[model samples]
Target: DVKVTQSSRYLVKRTGEKVFLECVQDMDHENMFWYRQDPGLGLRLIYFSYDVKMKEKGDIPEGYSVSREKKERFSLILESASTNQTSMYLCASSLRDGGYTFGSGTRLTVV
Candidate 1:
């Protein structure tokens, strides 16, 4: 069975600190994404990778970066986390047929 797992379910960080969010997939999905979920703004794409060592900037990539050194793992990095960056981060893997499997999500709070 395919499974997506996130390293953290909840986190708290201070302003201006660097943050790392990790995600892993049991299935070797070619497409993966980092999405931020806000109450009113909905889901915003932060970064995505279609293949290992290949990453593309998403809609809101200003303060974030992504790494996919291995096909089964994707990492999201915050250059300098700010209060505005605090939110729920979701990691997702997509199958060729467009089916998506998402992790439980990591909720980050910046103070």
Candidate 2:
């Protein structure tokens, strides 16, 4: 079975702090993605990468960045945390077929 691992299930940060969320996928997937979900807004993509050292910006990436240093690992960074940025972050991996294997997700709270 395919598995995507997110390093944290919950996080609490103060405003103006930097936050990092990590994800790792075991399978040799060709694509990985990061998305943040809020109450009113559905899952909005933050970033995605198809190959190592190659990344594409997603729909809402205002204060976020991503790193895909290795094929199995993807990391999401919140440049400066804010109260409005608190949301559930999801990580997913997929192949050419477009079926996604997702992590449990990390819930971030900024106070």
lDDT of 1 by residue, 1-111 (tens): 679999999999999999999999999899999999999998999999999999999998998988899999999999899999989999999977888999999999999
Off by over 4 Å in 1: none
For candidate 2, the 10 contiguous residues with the lowest summed lDDT are 35-44
- Stretches of candidate 2 exceeding 4 Å from the true structure: none
**Clashing residue pairs, backbone N/CA/C < 3 A, model 2:** none
Residue 68 local lDDT, model 2: 89
Q: Rate the local accuracy (lDDT) of all candidates.
A: 0.95, 0.94
User: What tens digits encode model 2's per-residue C-alpha lDDT throughout 1-111?
Assistant: 779999999999999999999999999998999998888988999999999979999999899888988999999999999999989999999998999999999999999
